[model samples]
Target: MTETQIWALVFVALTFSVYIYIAWRSRVRETRGFFVAEQNVPAIANGAAVAADWMSAASFISMAGLIAFLGSDGSVYLMGWTGGYVLLALLLAPYLRKWGKFTVPEFVGDRFSETVRSVAAVVAIIVSFTYVVGQMAGGGIVFSRFLEIPQAGGVAIAAAVIFTYAVFGGMKGITWTQVAQYTVMIVAYLIPAWAVAHTITGIPVPQVSFGRILEELNALQAEFGLDQYTQAFTARPQLDVFLVTMALMIGTAGLPHVIIRFYTTKSVRGSRWSALWALVFIALLYTTAPAVGAFTKFNLLQGVQGQPVDALPQWVQNWQATGLVSVSESADTITSITNKATVFADGGADLLVNNDILVLASPEIAGLPAPIVGLVAAGGLAAAMSTAAGLLLVISSSVSHDLYFRYVDHHASEARRLGVSRIAMGLAVLVAIYFGINPPAFVAQVVAFAFGLAASTFFPLLVLGVFWKRTNAAGAVSGMLAGLAFTGSYMIHTLEVFGTSAHEYVFGISPEGIGTLGAVVNLVVTIVVSLATRPPSHEVQEMVEQIRYPAEREEVGAN
Candidate 1:
């Protein structure tokens, strides 16, 4: 194997060893321990776990590339994701903790009805599974590049690692493992970013250096006859950008895996504080992303602009061989060294560059040392694997805890429940691996679908369930179904799943941005349906009131 490949394997092995040790140490015997860490995790540790879980491969690998190419328009991801944590802290986390549920569907089931619970469980599975596919695809990319394996092989390796800890140790094991992963991923992300920032502007702090980098980038883009990176809106329309950002922000609060993190905290206060800490950790990366994107773009333009394809740098050649970067000649002359348009843009350009390769290739593009390159690989793996594990747990819990244990055999023993959870987790991992092997689109694109779905189906229900005591089970169920149907149909139509273009999108919103509309649809449907139906029973309203007041609750133990 090459030196880079060997270093990657060594880092992967060392990280996996640490995760295994933590999982083994935190092994649980009861269903409560397996599902929610016995609600004993400290606030800070839970915060780090939430950070690791929230920032998936999309944030680590693709966000910078999107910012690099889309320029100011890419701030949608930055603002949407980080801003969502604020929504979580203010609107969701503490109240959910006070309710003290193992899974999101359990809360829905209690507040609404068993029927609504079943619907919520199905929504959770769909959202979690869609999200897991993206994480696995991200892991596959890291493995394919660093470990010199096929994408399928990389996905299988990730599946095995996640299955080992997630299936065996459950949430208790996964929580501690996530804390370690948060450390690895953040360090991995910051090191190369700092290196690149220092190289470009003599600044060590990437977030602080971003302004200086943007100034330089503006001058460079003008010189190259391209659009300015500092422009407020470049590739996408401003309204669409705003809508997409809103969807992402609301979607963050709606994501099932992220919501479940609060369930592991020791108390309602811990859950609230945990959201703050989670954002602090997440911001460490999110704030640096634009800097990474800007600097990487500046570096690439300096190296490849006006340079002949035959005389391109060794890194370009290596990337070209991976099929992420391609060169085409027209009349024996190379026109463009890299295409900056979206990957899904119609009519493929001559020099097609995959945005996903931006971060992975940034170290080499900056001419960094081999060790740093290897570290980037490890960081990407940590990001992808951490998210995959969290998503798998969400899917497993929905199936085993919500559907199987709750509905199949409510009288089953704890041991039986734990066994069913492990089996469900294993099956979920297999399904995710299969989808990873044959991904529907780019990693970030698939993840956007997950966010949109979550925003549409869950965000409205959760927000109104807590804030509006009049929201009945019928309204919640109808609203969820309407949102899912509209969003799914819109996606199918826009994505051209039926081999014909419907092109009936509202206000020119892309599939990624449609979640906001879906959320709106859900809200309207909920209000209309609730007005037509009877209000929630007094007991349900009392439960909502209890969750609202943290001081009125007693700590309930597992049955």
Candidate 2:
């Protein structure tokens, strides 16, 4: 194969080997070990794992691409995602760690009732399933480009690998695998960014060096009769930005896969420390994303905006072969194009560029080396695969641990529980592959929907469950169902799948921003219903009070 393909295969194989080895080495026999890594993972390792899990394909493969095109509006994603971690650490992580539950549904079930627990389990399954779709699609994109395979082939290969580790390794194996993935992801992301930043701005610090590039990008946009790249509210409404940011922030706190990371830590202190370390690891990538976005935007405009269709760069041509990027004289038929409004204005250059391919193609667009491109391919896959494994575990635990063991067979043996969990994960992998092949939206957007759903369904429940002692089982159930139904239906009605027009949106809010409203709905319904109904039992109230504080007995025992 080609040099880039060879290098990509080499890095991918090496990383996959490491992941499989870790999974095999760390495989667990007991349910506790499978679910929470025996609650013995150190703070630093869990932190890196959390960072890797949270970043996902959306952060590594698609966030910068969104920023490249959406410009200043994309800052909402950066702010929302990072800010959500702060919320998680301060408001949720330590409390959950204090409770020391294996899954989020377990917390809900214990805090409320068995019925609420079952509902929460179903909600967790739905949210995790939706989230995995983006991961599969992201992995497919990376493999299709670098490995020179069809997207379907790429997705199947990734599914098999994810199954090998996630189904076999459980949470213990997934944890260590994610730590390795974090190293791969961060290095792959930063190295190319460092190289390009230094090459273009003569500065290696991409985060601080992108100001000059942003200015030039704005100037290029003005020349092309397009809106300035740094201009905000031009592509999206102001309210939508605020609402979407809120959804993403709370959504990050609410995501089950992310929350479960804190539960893996040894103590509440460890959980808090893990959050801090995760932010440190995450910031390394987040700070540099703007630079990568700016550099890619500048390069594409300067290098290919008006270039001949037949004479495009090899990277563009390569992507075009995957059917994601299209260049044609016809404006209506192209898949994606920057500034389509301006490009169509004067017998214009019809250069269609899918945002998903922008980051993967960034290195080649900047004329970086084949090895760097391959490294990036591996990084993107790492990001996708890491999150995919975490999501599968969530689904497995929700079904086998939360549903089957708790409800179907209350006395099921450890071996039976593990078997069911693996089977659930295997099924989840197959379903995720199907959705990956037929995705509802671009990677980031589909993930946005998941975040929105989580924010609406779980954020209010978890927050109220922890802080408000009077929150009864009835209220929690009503709030969760209301929030989920509202948010899910709104997304279905407004998203492209249902063909709803933007004009029909509720007060001009986009599907991505509706979760903020849904969260509010949940909070209101929960509070009102709780006030009207019987309060929680004295024991449940005491449990809430205890989880609110540190687990001193456990801490003393451990010490």
Candidate 3:
């Protein structure tokens, strides 16, 4: 094996060993332990788990790429994702923890009706499955690139690893495993970013070096006659960006994997504090993303601009061989002596830059050492694996606990439920692996669709159910179905999933932004239906009040 592959394997093996050790130590014996870590995880550890769960492969691998290509427009993901945690902390986390459920669907079922719970469980599965596909695909990319394996092989390995931990350790195991993952991923992300930032501006801190980097980037843009990197807006309409941001924030609040993390914490206060710490851990990477993007882009321009094709750096040739970067000869070429690759060329050997390469290839492009590059590869695996484990656990719990145990056989033994959960988790991992082997779109795009679905279907229901006691089962079910239908249909139409062209859109909103409109429809439909229909029973109203107050939680615990 090559030295790079050897180093990558060492890093991957060490990280995997740590995860397995944690999982082995935290093995569970009962259904509650499997589903919610027996509700005993400390605040700091739960915070790290939440961070690992929330910052998935998309955040690690694609967010910077999006910023690299979209320029200022990419701020939507940074602001939207981080801001959603604020909503989670203040609006959802403590209330859900106080409500005290093993799964998000359980909360819905208790608050509304069995029918609503089933629907929410199905929605949870769909959203988690969608999200897991991106994580699997991201793992595939990392493995395929660093381990010299096929993408399919990489995905299968990821699935196997996730299955081992999630099936055996359940929430208890995954929570501690995620703490380790968060540490690895954050370190991996910041090292190259800081190294590149210091190399460019002599500023060791990337977040604080934005002004200097931006100035250098704008100068490079001017030299190449390209659009200024510091421009406030680009060809993408500003309204569309705003709507996408809104959808992401709402979706983040509603994601089942994220919501379930709070259930693993010790108390409502732990859940609240965990959310705060998650935001801090997540912000470490989110804040550094733009700096990484800007510096990577600047490096690319500097390396390729006015340089002869044959004289280009080895990194360019290496990535070009992978088909991520390509060169095409100009139609009108000068004498052989003048023929060269130029960023400003109308028809020269213009570089067709794929944005996804920004993060994965950053170490190589910046001439960093092999060990740093291997750490990045390992970091990518941690990101994908951490999120995949969380997604798979949620899917497993929704099937075994919510659907099977709650609906099919309520009297099943704890051991039986645990067996079912492990089996369900394995099956879910297989399904995600299949999708990863044949993805429909880019990892980030697929993840965005998952977010849109979550925003449209779950966010409104959970929010209204907690805050508005009058939201009966009929209204909640109707709102969820309406939002899902509208959002799903619009996504299908806009994405041309059925091969139908989209000639018109409501206010020209893209599929990514349609969730906001669907959310509005959900709220209006729910309010109107609640008014027309009977209010919830007095007992249910009391439960809502109990959820709103921490002191009443003792009564709930007694149950």
Candidate 4:
């Protein structure tokens, strides 16, 4: 590590300190406080917290890296994440908050039926665990890269820290801590992206510079005999893929962890304001990633040409020491491993160049010193931790609200419920740590899976449930199950069961984006099933109306 790297570490450490301090100071005592920060959070603060928690490692580390490698094709994530927020502001947040529940499972149960609520609880746990594992893995990647530790060791350290804050403090603690984490992650993501952009095209605003880079990228592709790659996608009508994107856009509004954030707001208006705040905060990083990606790609093509395959710049060397970057050793090995030849150290560098490292490798490609690289590591960690904490809250509440209060002990005191929540939180952290050590998948890839699942399973039901008066419990359950089953089975057969070398793709659409089909099947099944079943009861229809309007309705009307 260089002199600059030491200072970057200091800044990152200071950021962590601030998160701990703020979270500790904000610890809440009541069950409501633990669940929703006692509903006392200001709109701006809650928004920041939501944004920080929502933008995970994939947003910080993986998306840029994906963009760096995929060029214009990478805008999927930019669109997916941002589109989710728009859906939130336009459709989900206001109604969800007006429903006035601390946990999404609780709302689902109340809205549809106890059975539907029970099913939603299962889905929430799966979604949160799957998503949070990615966050924890991302944290491990940051730790490995910056702290010069083994991947498992790094994951352990991060898990320990996440556990300390999430278990002890609850939502009140996690909420304020997320606000601090938001500042760290956004600054870390933007500053380096800005520096890289200025160096590449002399532009201070990364969004503009990124556009310029894309122009040059188009030219570069023409030079590299890759004009077809650039032009091929245009002519390629990915109908199924288009469907997946639709599902994702619909799904974003319904994610349980994301939905729960609205409950922290003191009022319906505050929820609206928080959504806007999240959008603003998210925009800072999203706007910059395209630039960072193009610049990194350009620099990589320049830096790594024809050298000894293992030769990397100082920062690259440092990252290798840290382990954020992975490689397969031979072209044949990559061919054998297919596109995912991402495992490092055991003869993979010559075999494959992981696209995941593109952002982490940016400084090295540009010959920037280690300190900037270190800062990137810190940024990645902030993103992971912030999102992980938010997910943990959701997971904890799944047990506390859905199972404990609903079935285990309907009369359990609030304090007893809180204690159960802490236990659940601790268990969630343990599960996250387990996945982090033995990573099940790529950071961005895993997140995409979660999104697709959300799109197919959660989004359709929530949207229909909220807006379509005819959508009933039978439809919701059938839709969610069909979406989940179709997506999972199709992806496994198409992506994993069939090898990439054999060209195992379903109509050339990736598993990462294919759930769009599942979503459609879900909607169709839901419609069919609802038609087959009776309309929801009067009380359920009335519940829908309560969430739709802003004016205060009678308490009798609310239930």
lDDT of 3: 0.86
* lDDT winner between candidates 3 and 4: 3
Stretches off by above 4 angstroms in model 3 are 329-349, 498-506, 552-559
Instruction: Residues 249-275, candidate 1: write the lDDT tens digits.
Output: 999999999999999999999999999
Name the 10 consecutive residues with the lowest summed lDDT in model 2: 332-341
Instruction: Give per-residue lDDT, candidate 3, residue 516.
Output: 85
Report the C-alpha lDDT of model 3 over 1-559, residue by residue, as the tens digit: 8677788899999999898888888888998889999999999889899999999999998889778767788888999898989889988999999989799999999999999999999999999988998999899888888897889999998778777778889998899899999999999999999999889889989898867878778877667666678786673577888898899999999999999999988888898889988898899999999989888888877887777667777777766655666665652311111112244255533566666667988988999988998899999999999999999999999998889887678888878888889999888888898999998777888898888989988999999999999999999999999999999999888775556776566676888888888898998898899889999999999999988877544565585
lDDT digits (tens) for residues 201-314 of candidate 2: 999999989997878889887766668898999878899999999999999999999999999999999999999999999999998898899998888888765565666678
Score candidate 4 by lDDT: 0.75
TM-score (C-alpha) between model 3 and the true structure: 0.94
TM-score of model 2 relative to the true fold? 0.95
Query: In what order do the candidates fall by TM-score, top score first?
Result: 1, 2, 3, 4
Which runs of model 1 end up more than 4 angstroms from their true locations?
223-225, 331-350, 498-505, 553-559
Per-model TM-score, in order, reads 0.95, 0.95, 0.94, 0.90
- Candidate 2 regions with alpha-carbon error over 4 angstroms: 330-349, 498-503, 553-559
Runs off by more than 4 Å, candidate 4: 1-5, 222-237, 306-312, 322-351, 497-503, 553-559
| Candidate 3 lowest-lDDT run of ten | 331-340
Q: Rank the candidates by lDDT, best first.
A: 2, 1, 3, 4
Error of 2 at 233 (Å): 1.0
As for candidate 2, its clashing pairs are 336-352, 336-353
